[model samples]
Target: MGNIVSCCSLDENKKYLNDDEILETFSNSEINEFKKRLKNNIQIVVLLQDGTKLPCNLQANFQEKTLCISCHQKVKNKND
Candidate 1:
């Protein structure tokens, strides 16, 4: 049998990410580029470690100080 792969670390206590935590994952230039793409309505895909490309629309949750992705369900279904 093949070993199962997990996309994210299992952390039962974790719920949501804060601003700093989210920003830390990307460089300043990358963040700027993402914002520009978001404004232009350009399509973007997140490349996963498992070699899956998940189509996403980036959005900010200011109240929560977090970033979110509105994924394309069709793409996800096809990939799965």
Candidate 2:
């Protein structure tokens, strides 16, 4: 399917935000939440090799290969 995600807002990054920024009713570990998402999002640029896909502007690549112009181009196109 298309990135229908764009049509439906996904708040993939409400973690970094402090408690004051989000809805009330706290009860769990925000860091843990971030850790879960970190599993699959390791970008090639801006160097976040910790494997944590934090709210960044770069793109993700897990091919065990280095980032190249082609990868950058793909990320650009995806945003377009």
Candidate 3:
């Protein structure tokens, strides 16, 4: 699995993002690049502003070059 190259904080009340709101965090070019480099299943991670890292299964549409974080569990922060 590839590790995260960068991090961005998305401060929102919604813990889970719906399919339609997948592009909220990334741009078209970013998504395209991601899809192009995706050889197989990869680990999807969501990092909160409070330093909580949540692992989740993200749905990717290669043809559409889109990704969706439908759901994720709130895991305790390692620092805690």
**Candidate with maximal lDDT:** 1
lDDT of 2 by residue, 1-80 (tens): 55564656657864565667563445467755644445445444443355533344332243654332223332222233
For model 2, the run of ten residues with the poorest summed lDDT: 69-78
lDDT of the structure predicted as candidate 3 = 0.69
Please give the range of 10 consecutive residues that has the lowest summed lDDT in model 1. 71-80
RMSD in Å for all candidates: 10.0, 14.6, 15.2
Task: Write the number of the candidate with greater lDDT, choosing between 1 and 3.
Answer: 1
lDDT of 3 at 39: 35
Off by over 4 Å in 1: 1-42, 74-80
TM-score of each: 0.35, 0.21, 0.35
lDDT by residue (1-80, candidate 3, tens digit) is 78987787766875887887777788989987876555344567778788777786666676887776644575664663
Model 2 residue 25 distance off true place after TM-score fit, in angstroms: 16
**Model 3: how large is the Cα RMSD against the reference?**
15.2
Give the deviation of candidate 1 from the true structure as CA RMSD: 10.0
What is the per-residue lDDT of model 1 for residues 1-80, given as tens digits with 9 covering 90 to 100?
77769756877896788998888989989988877665555556988766888887777654677666777654434343
